[model samples]
Target: MKTYTCQCGTPLFFGNRQCVECGLDAGWCDVCSETAAVSPEGTCVSCGTSVVPCANRTTYDVCNCFVDASLAEPGTLCRSCGMTTMVPDTSLPANVRRWALLEAAKRRLLYDFRTVGYPDDQLTALPPLAFRFLSDTPDKHVVTGHANGVITINTSEADPVHRESTRQQFGEPHRTLIGHMRHETGHFFWMREIEGRRDAEATRLFGDADANPYAETMKQYYEQGPPEDWNEQFISTYAASHPWEDFAETYAFYLDMRAVLDTLRWNAPEQVQDLGDDLPSMLATYCSAGIVLNEINRTMGLTDLVPEVVPPAVVSKLQFVHDVFESLRTGVVSQS
Candidate 1:
């Protein structure tokens, strides 16, 4: 993710709602990928559009996106909120905050996608990436995953304590609402962009996409953990469970790497320079950044932010993912 700055020159974050330096309201300009100060009248100077806070923001305080009111009908949502197929019961105060956390993460994910040229409008038009923020009840346990372009996230994951406990239970060093979104959205993209057309290449890199006995596969995975040599090939133990998961995990890592590198470049352009084209060069830059970042985290008494070491095998898979994303961006691969 690139670092954004307010019109007042204060550095802004992806989720920033106000500029600390100037005390002005901030709204994301999708066209320019920057957080610009909104006029008191809620107009976007960059695009000259009459804008308003996204409905999700006004009603639930869950979003920071601004919609172009002239282009959209009355009560229309912004690009990110428009993609939500479901939201938790906001009548409950806890659910309201949980949904807000989920929406914040979702908006960041959408921003990253847009930065890579996969704008929400284009993505929604083709295969339609959507979301469902659900809460588990006595009768229904919400499992987080992607199916048919819809990514479902259990609202419980929004609670840091519960999320940490679940992460520990799964033996995962890194797991967050955004991480889940990135991983599941990886599955959605694979289905939309690569599944049938690039199955041969995907199978060669990950595994057979067609051999999907999902329930039995997952059952076996939980019954007996990943293979002893799993670390040599897969990004994580969960990734080793299935070919599809392997792809998604690797895809998520690719996004993570891209985000870290982009931030590093944005903060220190002269020192970081360009991340090279090849996988090895990119990994080298990422590892260096990870080392510095982990040390900073340690100072704060937090765990290593980017914990997993990328093996050669995983690097190969990342290369494939990067290529696929490039294909998607450039229309090198036919959507049909």
Candidate 2:
């Protein structure tokens, strides 16, 4: 995660409503590529209204969610906030804190999405994206990942202990708010790329999405183990279940590299900074930087935090994903 400083030089929270040193208002706006200057009235392009100020502003630290409605016509709510199809049942006893944690983590996810050039309404001028946050039983509400242009987040994920336990059970090396964003956005991109564009063709290349995504296949896998040689190609054993899973994992891997490259470009000296903006150069930089990060983690008595290696087969898949985004960025691919 990148550190942000207020214009006044005081460090501010990622979702800060006001800067302490200069009294300037600020909120992260990914489209603008900087911390947006929040108008004193609390208006911002991201949220479209003045944030509700903390009642205990003097005593407690909190992120600002202000929006100023009076200054001008209200824009849609912030991209992440707007996607909330459901909030936790506030009426329930233990839900209030859970909801708060979910919202806070969500803001961090949105920050990553916007910063990494994924489309948010603020960046694309599209209709607001939507999301649902709900609770369910382990037997009843299986959270199958899918994106039909809208997102659904199981509210249980808000529990830190539950998330950490699942991370350990799954043997995942890294997991966090930003990691979820990278993973789910993979589903979102699949919806964008596969929708109405030769679905049959994709099925031939990828696989049949028509297969019951929620099926006994997963139950069988959990009881048994992933197929043999799963590690030879797939990032995780679960990814080998279906092609859609493959695409999502592959997309997440590409996002990991993309963000690493951006961090490199920001930190490198100007003399060596002009690496060509192509998949090969970016991939090379990602590998080089990844080695340094791995070594540093070991120095600190931690394991290689990102254990997955990018083999040749995975690199080919990543290049296809990168080329698709490059075409989108350059307008070489028409939206129609």
Candidate 3:
């Protein structure tokens, strides 16, 4: 989550479509790894790759990513949108906006993945990653989860009113489109990168993913709730529902903390440090910054921006996640 700037020096963000200072069209340059100005024809200035704005952007204003025309098939989607296997029926008026929100979150997740060296090609091959944004209809109930590398999300979660009500019903303290994308993609990556690797050690930390019947475990979890002492070891109550979920929830928090820390390092370098080797120090920096952010939200009559406390046990889980990410990134083991 590095801060980007317009060629003219105006600070930009990952999702910016236009530079406010230069009034030039802006987009993410996959080659340059930053938001840069796009020519009227949508070419990447640095790479000289002939690009086109994603189809979803042109048709539905849901994406800002550019597809490399030379690499993609004619009339095909950009890297992010191409991963979508299904979308809600566009004939329904509300579905368009909901799908847009979902796409925005997906693109953010993809951007973070790429920043961390998980390229789209590597992820979408073999046990490929894909998405289905579906709406619950009279005839079908859309459940959100990942299976066989495909992630499905219910579009109803995009509507704030509906989302808030459901969050309250489930007694969840925090819920967002981005959170759901990060959490579910965790499942896909776990299956793809760690599931059967002879040397992978996630099973030792999170418990065997295949040790129990997932459906029955979750059914009982929903009916009886997580163990009363769940907070002692799990990041969230839902995470205690099953081993796979424990991994996903911890993985999602790792992404969350890393993104926030990156932003802090960019904007407040004096207060943060480049202590990448010290996980405990990084978490302390995040918590210190989060307290200030929570105060700002309080002043605005809003909820805390980051509410969860990272207990010692949860920090150990996050450290394991970091080790796995490092192994995946560098193709070397971080620890025995």
Best by lDDT: 1
lDDT of 3 by residue, 1-336 (tens): 777766688887878878898787777765555667776776776467777667777788777777676776656677678789999999887999999899889878876785465645668687688999999999999999999989999999999999999989988877899999999988887777677862246766777767768989999999999999988889899899998899899888878877777777778887686545457877888788889989999999988877878888888878877767767777887763
Which residue segments of model 1 deviate by more than 4 Å? 119-122, 333-336
Best by TM-score: 1
Give the per-residue lDDT of model 2 (tens digit) for 1-336: 455676456766665666777877666553344455555665543445444333212122223444333332334344445466665566775665665566676676665564455554433334345556667755768472555556566766767788889889987787665566667767777777654764664465456777837367667677877788877667777677677777788888777776666555655545227557677777776776778789989999986755678766666667667766666555576332
TM-score of each: 0.93, 0.76, 0.92
Once fitted onto the true fold, the runs of candidate 3 whose alpha carbons sit more than 4 angstroms away are 45-49, 69-74, 119-121, 198-200
Clashing pairs in 3: none
Q: How accurate is candidate 1 locally (lDDT)?
A: 0.81
Give the candidates in order of TM-score, highest first.
1, 3, 2
TM-score of candidate 1 against the unseen true structure: 0.93
lDDT on C-alpha atoms for all candidate structures: 0.81, 0.61, 0.80
